[model samples]
Target chain A: MKSRKTTAWIALCASTLLAGPALAESHGMALSGDLRIISDMSNPAPRAVMEGMVADFGEMHPDLNIELTIVDREAWKTQIRNALGANPPDVVNWYAANRMLPYVNAGLFADVSDLWEEPAFEALASTKGAMTINDAQWGVPYTYYQWGIYYRKDIFDELGLSEPTTWEEEKANCQAILDSGRKCYTIGTKFLWTAGGWFDYINSRTNGYDFHMQLARGEIPWTDDRVRQTFANWRELIDMGAFIDDHQTYSWQEALPFMVNGEAASYLMGNFAVAAMRDGGLTDDQLDFYQFPKIAEVDYAEDAPTDTFHIASGAQNMDAAKEFLRFVVSTENQTKINAGDALGQLPVNANAEIGDDKFLQQGFDMLSNNASGGIMQFFDRDFPAEMASFGMEGLQEFMVFPDNLDDILARLEDARQRIYK
Target chain B: MFPTPIEKRSRAAQLSYQSLLPLALILWLLPLLAVANFSIKPESDFVNGNYWGLPSSFDLFANYGRVFFESNMPRYLLNSLLITIPTVIGAVALSAMAGFALGVYRFKGNLLIFFMFIAGNFVPFQILMVPVRDLTIDMNLYDTKTGLILFHIAFQTGFCTLFMRNFIRALPFPLIEAARVEGVAEWKIFWYVVLPLMKPALAALAVLIFTFIWNDYFWAVVLTQGPDAQPVTAGITEFNSQFRAAYHLMSAGSIVAALPPVAMFFLMQKHFIAGLTLGAVK
Candidate 1:
């Protein structure tokens, strides 16, 4: 009996050892050392999902060790800078384009051009032009979400209203919502820059695409008449009692309650807000999406920019990291990411199928139809970090004290000059 | 033959004063109450604009469990304790020794060094960010708990020394002189005589350092990146990004993160107040 037990134990140990490396090979390429992926997803939904993904990744690569640290967005940025300054992680999730430009210029991210040639990435590369920079691909595109107005469909139905197709129609709808004793819009500017999303979309719709890009690039002054006109339109809406009171004191999350309670008719937000809307007890039947409405008579193109992930140039496991990138952008994973309600992001791989999510399908269909002529990077991601900070602060000032547009624009222009110089 | 009896106040005045106490206490505790209320509220309560009102449902246990089980909060709390405890001990011990030297002995550069500590403690953290990070890296201490604790001890020593020095300066010199006259060894004098009298100061310094280090967000971010070293404050912030609009959960997490120091303060209130008021008397 003792001899039989010893033989069984030995066989068990041998089996375990044999299974480990096979598991490691399944999750793309295995790394000899530990891997760390840092993100800013500390909330329950995304955190739970990410933890599962990390576990799955670990199971598939038994030889590789994985560590995930979610820091606050602000602290994450600061920590990433400090970490890159010291020793870069094996793989990191960071922004692409100008946001990635500084880190790329600093030689902090691995150049994943070879992975871009792989069939999985090739499909994504053809679909997402923004992820490619200067003929070199930097990162994998895992999630792409559209930003627009999320309105209460139930309230619109109750009030006999329809989605507006024009700027004038949107204003009239907002006015009617207000006339019915409800706030037409709910927004918060507590961190200051959140208001910039509204400003960006509105300005893009009003002044057309190229002008907005020019403003972001500093080729056009912030104090230009076109810029002032955007604020003017916003002020007109504010004067009609269209926005929530004390908005300057509230954050985006804080203002969400108003929309969910039917106290406010609409929220201008990203696809991320879908989870919040659900958490707020607003059913699928209660929510709907609409474009920001055409502010210009000219048929200008619409552009929607998205957040992308890249490996740091100083990555210790460049080859392994690229393999991981290829795995993430693969049609299989992108479909999984899109099908999940928590993520609900549009897959950048054109050939990848998105599951039956109504809102996601709407965003995908809109993009496919080329309803938006051109895509522009989100204001914060498009401009240099410092300039973006200044612009956000300016947006807060404009919202809180609309009469200070001249001073706000002047301050923004000064900030632009300093950063550009 | 004696003192006149004191007159009683009117019933209305007494009622007003009695009413004012709870009212004032409530006013003073409004912000904390708000956080506490928000912590137990269902996400729908906030979404339905029920903020500043009674919660529709209590979810304290659920939220609290989620904070620990769903995130790295327990790990963060453990990291915080590891970083904070050693820092408190090191800073207090080092400053106590240095404070004794400066306070008991009239040495050259004593005031200069004291003033330097005072000034260094006041400089903004941003100015020190680049150089300090580089120094941490070069020391091969980057991303370690020890690296963060070491820097925090070194940085906090400035303030701790100031506090300890002044505290020791106010101690009567006759005892030290008597010990010296009796030929008590210098080390013995410091250990047996001086340390015994430093209980209040030590208690004060310990609580203060505990709070400071526990609440530290900037250094936690700068010195660490992963759960292996990051603390609760940074952890909560990271949690915020994932939940986005889940304020109830965020508030619950914030309260959980904030409770330790708050409980510490309450338990050590006397020592903390005594330490804070050390220089205020003279």
Candidate 2:
């Protein structure tokens, strides 16, 4: 009888728990984010930085209650679109530039242009181009990192080679590395975006920055003469066998072993690859950085991906959400988040000090260099999702069969017409 | 016994069968063993590319401790328990009644109702995501453990009813007839007579539901968000940070997540085996 009564009570309690309101009953402003700025789950530094910023924002508006939800990063990439639908959160963490353009067209994000009118907005002055779409500013960028050619420093020293500044000089360096019995570039194109990095460089260099950005924004056709020239430059590298053999079999991470094993001399990738290389036991002295070699008579334009946060179109607490955005882009908060477990990204705020860390310093010199035609937020972030997917698939196919360039370009043009509409 | 119990075979045949048993078990368990090995080794071993070698240092404590203490795993585990136990009880309760009604009643459309439940089990789950999500939102249950649990119970009833209806049909009919001659009411006949005989099936189905709901990752992510509603399987993904995936911690998380189902299996091993083989022999 006692056991039966216990079972009955347990069932009742279970039912009540399932039907009860969620942990916090008080309704508040909701801000959803992609979690984990670092690989370690035990690392509290990243959360401390974000929460510290949030607490300060809370203090300024005591009447408003705010709740933040940070989901896993990959899941967030898929679910952020859902956040824009019915039952929308007050604000969402997102990316800047052409990535935000389509959703802007859909009217999913609120117009924060008035936020730009506020004084002391000089912090993210350089990222203004990326943050703006259709002549109106959309979101505020908090953190972003640089992408460039991370090469074998020891090999360069041994062969007496310097950083390649032009296309011709880059070819000569590739030739030199080849003659020494090592390949120059090793990439994994199974997921396809890896090859898009090389395409971003070749296109930006061959046709200059304006045309390249226009191409990503779908203002130029895929089969345009400038696009053809970009492919021609990429084919030149492929014909010379500058990249590793059968790269389609490896992931971006898997290709790093070749660089570590000394079989490949360089990798065109993001700054995140540095920590992984260090994990593989490659010393700082062994690995070094340089911009992608210039291909045409164009100013250097680099791929520096930036992450941003925006107010949802149908948000309930608009004023509180705007206040949260204001705090996130502040020079102090940006500096704190960057200095915390988010160890890699350069703060969007110009005043945020680039610590004496050798990487941030080298990256700062390359990016802030006057020769830079300013930042392109990488291929995936700079193109609409549909067009980016089709382009990445085409890029992977081209990597495997460089001879099928015309067919690939024609197919991409067909997709572009349909997707842009 | 079926297949003449191998013991009646020649000595050589018996010896070969005994030898092959361990070999096949090892083949089946190899990947699981590798995951187990990974759960114990430090991240340095993987960094050094010592995948197949002995660990330089055992991190059995540190890895699991971090997964529990330093991560949102404890809360996630609690969320899973709250979501699953109720779902198992609710699904089994509903399915048992529906199965009994379909098996014993002479009602019209009985076959159609049973077929409808059976047909639902065959439809792909991915197709239900969008409409179901919208419905949950409309009901104000989206992003809650209650939403996930309720949806799990609804969908899982399809398979559970199929299992139960077939199991109920396989039982002897004269037992119910005997009880009816004694003027027992229909509901009493069900509660007293049929239910007492359903012990093996109930035990098997409860264990099966426990395993299914506990290991679920997709619906946990789809209908729920954050530590307040997500289960351990979804919580395991928190280790995959921005650029790099932490395989060592992920492996540790996976092992911890896999334990409840393994324990449930071992605890119900007898009833589970008996239920599976009941129809097979007859």
| Candidate 2 residue pairs in clash (backbone atoms < 3 Å) | none
* Cα lDDT tens digits for candidate 1, B216-241: 98888787766778888776765555
Question: Residue A79, candidate 1: how far off, in angstroms?
Answer: 6.8
Lowest lDDT block of 10, candidate 1 chain A: A12-21
Q: Least accurate stretch of 10 residues (summed lDDT) in model 2 chain B?
A: B43-52
What is the alpha-carbon lDDT for the whole of candidate 2?
A: 0.80
Per-candidate chain B TM: 0.86, 0.93
Cα lDDT for residue B152, candidate 1: 96
lDDT of 1 at A282: 88
Shift of residue A104 alpha carbon in model 2, Å:
3.0
